[model samples]
Target chain A: MSSADFGALKHPFVLRALEPSDYRKGYLKLLEQLTKVGEISEEEFTARVEETRHLGDLHHAVVIEDVERLAIVASATLLVELKFIRKCGKAGHIEDVVVDSTVRGQHLGQRIVDHLTELAKQLGCYKVILDCTEANVPFYEKCGFGLKERQMARYFS
Target chain B: MSSADFGALKHPFVLRALEPSDYRKGYLKLLEQLTKVGEISEEEFTARVEETRHLGDLHHAVVIEDVERLAIVASATLLVELKFIRKCGKAGHIEDVVVDSTVRGQHLGQRIVDHLTELAKQLGCYKVILDCTEANVPFYEKCGFGLKERQMARYFS
Candidate 1:
């Protein structure tokens, strides 16, 4: 569905690319419900958003904003990586997906993921991939993603 | 280790970022050693390289080049995603890692992965992650990556 089609969401909720003004909209606060979100000032938030904007259409940090409440209720980022393989095919990586704790049962997470997955296809990606904890496998499956491989990480202090 | 430290490798082998001129150096041909690489003209290759170049250091497509042969023998990309969490922290995702089949025993894959892992740390990434097939588990483990979660994928035609 196109951005114009988001009217299907409840009156107050709309999904769109993250904006600089989201700092005041509790964007970071909503993310804290998913993982550690250290204090981020408005300046830093806007600067980072500008840096991502320089990446052109390659970075999509989609968010579901509650317009009536002036707050972000859910978010996820779809990162497109250009590749030399598959004849320069693009690969889509969905990262940091989260739904505000208060909006748990609303299915906002699935809506945002499906939207990004479709965006990936529209961008000519050969595949869209994501890594998730065991508990979240069923959720992603419901969104049309199938288990593919194992995710390995090395943390840096 | 810094780029200069790559001298530890056998003579003529060095790891570095993907250069525009790499198109003439068999970079795309090298990737075909790992996966399907459809016909890509030199013009297209250089154009894509230029586009990726615009991303600055956020996209690092490192390669192990055989200077003597003027060919890219191994290659991988380290994509850094800016995050609002952890006070604007960054996360790194490694993709399309491959070592030429002809030079498999020289440990080029390990060397390249190690270099990118170190690069990610130097760039202040909270974690470096990758999705790999089961057969490659032992390989990445030797490079200091441990299984963290499952990778899910949805392919688009």
Candidate 2:
């Protein structure tokens, strides 16, 4: 199904990219709901915004905002990458997906991921991928992604 | 161990980033050694270079060169990323690792990954990640990368 068919918020909530003003405050509340729980001070937020602004457009941080409430409710990022092996030569990796704990079960997470998946297709990516815990597999499957491979990592000091 | 102690190629082989001239011919040779097994033409390689050059320093296309033979003998790319959860606020993703089939046993792949891991550390990344097939797991383990997690993926058409 097209992204439009994917369930989206109604009424006063809107889904869009974060603005400069969001860097000062508000996003931290929504960020706390992600798998990583924390409070990011405004200074760090501001720095990250500038660093990303300079890095250009490959990183898209999609935010679900409650227009009337003036708060971010849900969010995810689509990281597009150029590749050497894919038949289409590009790939999109979605990361840090989350829905506000207070707003779970509303299907906002599905809408946000669907939007990014459509964007990835439009950008000619051979694949749109994300790594989620086994518990979250069913959620991604709901968003039209099928489970395929395993993930590996190494942490450094 | 420091990146310098990472067992680099001996004799006339040197490791470094790909040069502009590499887009014309030698990269295809080096690419063949990667598990993907294919030839990338000059036009495609040039276009990809232009596309990613705008992505800035994150994509380090490190290559092993033979000063005496004047050819790229091995190659790999390290993609560094910023994050919200890590203590260091960044991550390193290694991709497209290749070691010339002719020079495969010399530990060129190990040095290339080691260099990128150190580069990632210097860039303040808290972890380094890469997805390889089950067969290649032992090779990455030799480079100080242990099996920690499974990498799951979903492919889109």
Candidate 3:
């Protein structure tokens, strides 16, 4: 479908505050996308999704959906995590920014990022950070993120 | 001096729990190392150190010393942060895992990681995470970490 066609695909693409009902569907979608990218194993993804859903009450998620049926197209979460660096004030970490591959080249990702950035600022974060692969550096840079000297580790054992 | 000679230099290295008196010096040491690595600008470093010292009260730091003086060989912090997913749980992020260059090749880094891992377990975290550059991947792997997925992002004006 053309960009305009997809844009008019009846998805309610508005940004809204995260809700509790969004957890199960959003977490499953995130797990599917992350597993597709080799980020987590099926088993770990299942466990992690369950764990994350439990944490749903603690954080916020924003979703884009189809207006009529309200099917989710993309989603991202803003986590209010404490920072040891007091100068950071309270920090917000953006996690699980995902858009369906069918619409990859479209501007959905950027829209979600913009929404989260504004949300972080409104939440009074001194800084907002999201970690991505080396390939995605330019994408985040365009979103006003400078390169941070941070790395990620996952524990399965 | 060579690594062996440096080890034999007999500087007073004290290993103790973080104390109110230790905040200023410890914060400066952290800022110095971060600045040396260019992770933060000098101005940003100064401001952040002051801020972290206040926040450090919520976390813990272990300092090393030689004889009668603190040497600041290594430190680890337990930062309370949120992780978003379907099964949300309390998370602890480990940061500022540092060991003096003079003490490289020693097991101090591993010791710090082990200590913090235990602390995370005690803090009731479902998981503990930290990010490092490619260069430090092997070190973290050796310390019992596996790879997670790479993050992707795009920015919009």
Candidate 3, residues B1-157, lDDT tens digits: the string is: 0011113223454455544444445544653554333233456655544544544322555545444544466666656554444234445667667776777787777767766666666655666777677788888888876665443322222
lDDT of 3 by residue, A17-114 (tens): 44445543444565467533333345654564454445443356667764554556677877655433444445667877888776677778888887
Which whole-number lDDT from 0 to 100 does residue B141 have in model 2? 84
lDDT of 2 by residue, B25-118 (tens): 3766567555453566667777776766666567766778887878888888887777666431777888888877887777788888888888
Q: Estimate each model's TM-score.
A: 0.94, 0.84, 0.61
Clashing residue pairs in candidate 1 (N, C-alpha, C atoms within 3 angstroms): none
Instruction: List where candidate 3 sits over 4 angstroms from the true fold.
Output: A1-11, A23-32, A35-60, A65-67, A80-92, A100-106, A121-127, A134-154, B1-17, B36-67, B70-72, B84-86, B89-92, B101-105, B121-127, B147-157
lDDT by residue (A50-141, candidate 2, tens digit) is 77656545677778887787878888877777777643177788877878887788888888998888877876777788877778888888
Q: Per-residue lDDT for A135 in model 2?
A: 84
Q: Model 3 TM-score?
A: 0.61
By the DockQ metric, which is better: model 1 or model 3? 1
lDDT at B65, model 3 = 47
Preferred candidate (DockQ higher): 2 or 3: 2
Q: Arrange candidates by lDDT, highest first: which order?
A: 1, 2, 3
Off by over 4 Å in 2: A1-8, A23-25, A35-39, B1-8, B33-44
Give the number of the best model, judged by DockQ.
1
